[model samples]
Target chain A: MKNINLLAMLSLLAILWSCGDDDDAKPAEFGTFQVYFDNKVGADDITRRDNGSTEYDFETSTGEKFNLSLLGYYVSKITLEGPNGEYFQDEMKASASEAKGYYHVLEGESASQNIKLEQVPAGTYNKITFAIGVEEDGVLEGAAGGVLDPADGAWFWNWNAGYIGFALEGTAENSGQEYVDWGGGRETLENTFAIHIGGWKDVADNENFINNIKTITLDFGTTVKVGPDLSPLAHLVTDAMKVLDGAAIDFSNTFSVHAPKAGKPFAEQLPQVFSVHHVHQSTSGHD
Target chain B: MISKTKKYLVYGWVLFLFWSCSDDDAASPKDIYAFEKPAHFPDATYTFENNPITKEGFELGKKLFFDPILSRDKSVSCNNCHQQSRAFADSPLHPTSIGVDNRVGIRNAPPLANLAFMQEFFWDGGVTHLDFVPINAIESDVEMDETLVNVVKKLNEHDEYPLLFEKAFGVKEITSPFMLHAISQFTAMMVSAGSRYDKYVLEGTALSNEEMAGMKLFEKKCATCHSGELFSDFSYRNNGLNDSFGDLGRGRITEDEADHGKFRVPSLRNAELTAPYMHNARFLTLEEVLDHYDGGMVDSPTLDPLFKDGDQVVGISLTTEEKTSIIAFIKTLTDRDFIAEPKFRNND
Candidate 1:
C-alpha cells in the first residue's frame, strides 16, 4: 500500500510540472495600421522660381487645385490609441535621410508615402496621436540620437545650433513681380525670411499647431493586412493649409510669439482646421 | 509538510535571485561626471549635445588622438604636431607642421589645450566649434589629407572600434556622430587651470620679481585685448603680422575687407611652451615675437588702432629687458600637471 501511494505522488508531481510549462507558452500576434497628414488647401502655397521669382497660389474649397509641390515637413512621435485606451507606440522616429524619409511630391502627383509599423501588439485602436513636426521641447533640451541628429542635416541651421521643424522650400511671387525663393529655419529668432515655427516657451503662439490631435479608429481581427486610404492624410494637410490662410493667421507665432509663459492659439484654430476632413472608415478593411 | 514547504521556499528564492541578477545586468551604464563649469569663466558657448562625454567616449577619443591611422598614409597623428610636453603646440624648430608625404602646412598648428573654453577655433576663426575642428585638420591638403567619410569607414572597419562604439553608444555600428563625439570627449577634457599663474590668482601664491614686473607690463599693454581667465577676448584683430600673406584670415569667412588681416587673438596660457609665433609661423622664438610686437607692426587699412599713431604706423615700443620680463611672466602660465596627466595619454 505504501509503495502504491509513493508512485501516485511522483506521477502527480510530474503532471503538475508539465502543466506549468504549458501555461508559460504564448503565441505572437501583430496588427497593421496607418496614420495620415493632409496638406492641400489650408494655407498659401508659396513657390519660389529658379530666377528668384515668387508666386502664391491660394486654395479654393469648391474646386480642388492640386498643390503637391509644397508638401514637405517632418512628422514624428506616432502613437495609436485603442478602443480600450491601450496605446501602441512606434519606437522608430522618422526623418529625412539619404537612404530613407526623402519625399518629393511634384505638382499633380500623389504626395504620400506609406510607412510600415511592424511588430505592433494586436489590438483595436481609436485615436492616432502624433506631432506635426519634431517636438520643440525635444530640440531645446538637447536630446541627442534619433532622426533629428544634427550630423544628418535634418536639424541643421548652417551655423546656428538648432533644428528646422517645418522646412517649406519653393518660389513665392513677391511684390516686385519676381519669384523670391524663401527657406526658413524652424526657429525664427534672427532671420526674417524663414518661418521657423518652433520654441518651447511660446511654441503654440509662435508655431501653427493647426494640425494636432488627429483621430482614426482601426479594428484588426487576426490577419496580415495592407489597408488603402493611407494617402488621405496628405489631403488633410493641404486642407489645413487653406483654413490657416483664410484666418490670415501666422502659424509661426500662433501659440506664443514673445514670452515663455504664454498660451498657444491652438484652442482657437484647431477646430476650424480639422473640421474640413470628416472621419471616414473602409468597409472592406483587409486589402 | 514542513519539508515540502521549505523546498517550495528555496525554489521561489532561486527564481527571484536569477531574475534580480538579470535585471542588474540589463541596466545601462551611468555617466561618470556632470558637465562642470569653472567659476572664473562665463557660461560655455558650446555644450556637449553633439558629443556627450562618457568615460568610454573620452577614452576612445584619446585613442584616436594618438593613432596615426587618421592620416592618409598613416604617417602623422594629431599628436605629432600637438605634443603634450610643449603644451600640445608645435616645437620652436618646426615653424610649419610637416604632414604626410613631407607636405608643409602654411600656418602653425596651435596648442590643443584649454580649447573647451574657446568660442572660435584657428587663427582665421573660420571654423566655429570644437566638433568641427578635427574636420579642418583631417581634410586640409597639408594636414591629414583624409575625408571624414573615409576616416569614419576606417574606424568602423577596425576590429576594436566596433566594441568601443558599443561601449560609448549602445549601438555596434560606428557613426560619424559617435566618432566626432568621442574625439570631442577627449578634446573637452583638456583643461589647464593648475598653472603657477592660476595659483597666484586663486591661492594667493607669490610670483618671482621678473614675473611680477612682466605682469605689470602685461596689465598695461596686453590685458586690453588678451583679457580675462582664458587670456583671450575671442575676437579677430589685425595684430600686424604682415600687410600681406595673400591669406586674408577672417576676411575669407565674412567676405569683408575690414577683416582682411584680422585673426582671432590666441590665448597666452601656454605661450611660453608653444613657440614659432604669429599666424603664418613666421617668428621662431619668443624673443622674435617680442621684437615683432616692439617694432614689427605693419600699417594697413584694417589694422587695429591699439598700436596706431596719428599716421597708424605698425609697432609697440618695449625695452629689451621689458620683453624678457614679459616672456618670464608667460612661463608661469605653464601647467605641468596638465602635460603629465595620464588621462590625456593614448590608451592604445
Candidate 2:
C-alpha cells in the first residue's frame, strides 16, 4: 500500500512539472515601428546639394523668401515610451564599421529620413524622446569609427574639436549682400549666410565644457500601437526657421554661429522644434 | 534528494559566478601599486577609478605604443618621435617629428611623463583628457596620418591584438574605447616622482651645494609658473617669445584674441633630457633657454604679467651665475629609474 502511495505521489509531481515550467514564465513579444522625420525650411521640402551648387527654395513664417544649399544634422539616442511602463531604449551605438542607433538627417538623403526600430516591446506607445546631436560622452570618447568618425568631414570640427549639431549652408537674398569665403575656402558664396550651430556646456565646478544636448522629447499626437498585426508610423517634422523665432536678434545682424555664445539662443529653440505631425495604426489585432 | 556529486557541482558553479562578479566591483584596487604617486606631489587628475589599471592591461598598452601599425604607412610609431632613451621627447635634431610619408609636424613633440597630473594635452591644450591625446597624433596629416577607424580594422584583423584586447577588456571584439583606455594605462604608468629632486624633498635625501642653490633660485624666480613637485601650475600664458602670434597657441584652441600667443606651461620634469626646448624647438640647450628668459623677451599683448614691468618685458631677473646654478637644479629632475622601468618597455 505504501509503494502504491509513493507511485501516485511521483506521478502527481511529474504532471505538475509538465505544466509549462519555463516557457510560460512571461514570454516576451516584440514588434516593428518607424519614426519618420520630414525636413523643411518652412513650407517647402528641404534638399541637400553635396557638390557644385544646389538651391533650397522655402519661405519663413513672415513670408520671407530664402534659399538653402546645405542642411544636415544628427538625430541620435532615441527612446520609445510605451503604455504600462514598457519602454524601448535604443542601443546608442556607432563605430567606424556601422551605426546601430545614430541617424544623420539630411535635406535630400533618404537613408536617414526614416529611422526604423525593431524588437520594440509590443504595446501602445505615446511618447518618443531623442537627442538632436551627439552627447558629451560621445564627443570626448576620442577616435570614434563609423557614423561617429571625425573623418566623415560633414559632421565634426577638426582643429577646435567638436561636432556641428545643426549645420545649414546656403545663400539668402536677404543676407545683406555679404559675400565672403565660407570655412576659409569651401567656395566664395555670394549673398550667403551659414549657421553652424554647435556649443558645449560646463558643469558646476568642472573646467571642461561639452557641446551636445541629451534630451529632446516629443508626444506622438496620438497613441501608436505596435503588435504582431499592428505596425504604427510616427511622422515628425524639423523646421529650420524656428531657431530664429523669438531670439530677439535679427538674422541680418548675425547669421554665423560656431560656438555657445551665438548658438545657445538657437539651441534653446531646438527642443521646441520637434513635434509629431501624425501617427498611423491599422485596425487589425495581434494575429 | 539530489546526488552528492550534483549538489557539489551546483555549489561550485555558484561560487564561480560570485568570483567572476567581483571584477565589476569599482572600489577594489586592481593593483597595490598601479599608479605609483609621490607623497609630495598633488593628487592625480585622471579618473583612475573608472578604468583601473591591471598588469595585463599595462602590458598590452606597451605593445601598442611600440607598434607602428597605427601609422598610415606602417612606418611611424609613437616611439619614433617619443623615444624612451630621450625621456620620451622628440629627437633633438628633428625640431618637428617626422611622420609617415616623411611628413613633418608643425610643433615639436612634447615629452610624455607625469601626464596624469596635467590638466590638458598638446601645446594648445586642445585635448582635455589623457585618453584623447593619442587621437590627435594618430590623425595628424603629418604625424601618424592614420584614421582611428582604420586602426580598429587593423587591430581586429591582427591575430594577437584581438586576444590581448580580450584579456584587457573582457569583450570578444576589440573596440576603440578599450584600446584608448589601454593606451592611457601605459601613459599613466610614466610617473617620474622618483627623481633626485623628489628624493631630496619628500625622502629627505641630500643634495649638492650647487643643486641646492639652483633649487632656491628656481623657487624664487620660476616657481610661480613651474610650481609644485610636478613642476607646473597648469596655466596657459604667453612668455613674450614673439611680438605677434604665428601659431596662436592657446588662442587658436580657445578662439579668444586675449589667449593668443599663450601656450601651456610645460612641466619641468626631466627637463635635462627633453632639450631643444619651447613649442618650436628654437632653444637647443639649457643655457640658450636661460639666456632667452634672462633677457631677449619680446613685447606682446598677451604676455604674462610676471615677465613684464609696465611697457617693457623684464623677463626673469637672474645673473649668469644664477642661470648656471638653476641648470644644475633642473638636471636633478631627470628620473632615470622611472624612464627605464622594464614594465614600460616593449616585451611583446
The complex in candidate 1 yields a DockQ of 0.04
Candidate 1 ranges with C-alpha deviation above 4 Å? A1-287, B1-39
Model 2 steric clash pairs: A95-A145, A95-A146, A96-A145, A96-A146, A200-A210, A200-A211
lDDT of 1 at B337: 88
Docking class of 2: incorrect
- Shares of reference contacts reproduced by the candidates, in order, are 0.01, 0.11
- List the lowest-lDDT window of 10 residues for candidate 2 chain A: A203-212
Q: What lDDT tens digits, residue by residue, belong to model 2 across residues B1-348?
A: 445555555555545544644555444564533686778878888757556788778888888899999888789888999977778998898988899878888788999998887767889887766776777888887899888778978999998999898888776877666777788888988887778988898879999999999999999998999998878887888887888878899776666677889888889999899878898887999999989898978887888999988988899978999999999999999999867877767775
Interface RMSD in Å per candidate, to 1 decimal?
12.2, 9.3
Docking class of 1: incorrect
Question: Could you tell me how far off, in angstroms, the CA of residue B135 lies in candidate 2 after the best superposition?
Answer: 2.3
Candidate 1 residue B233 C-alpha distance from true site, Å: 0.4
Q: Give the best candidate by TM-score.
A: 2
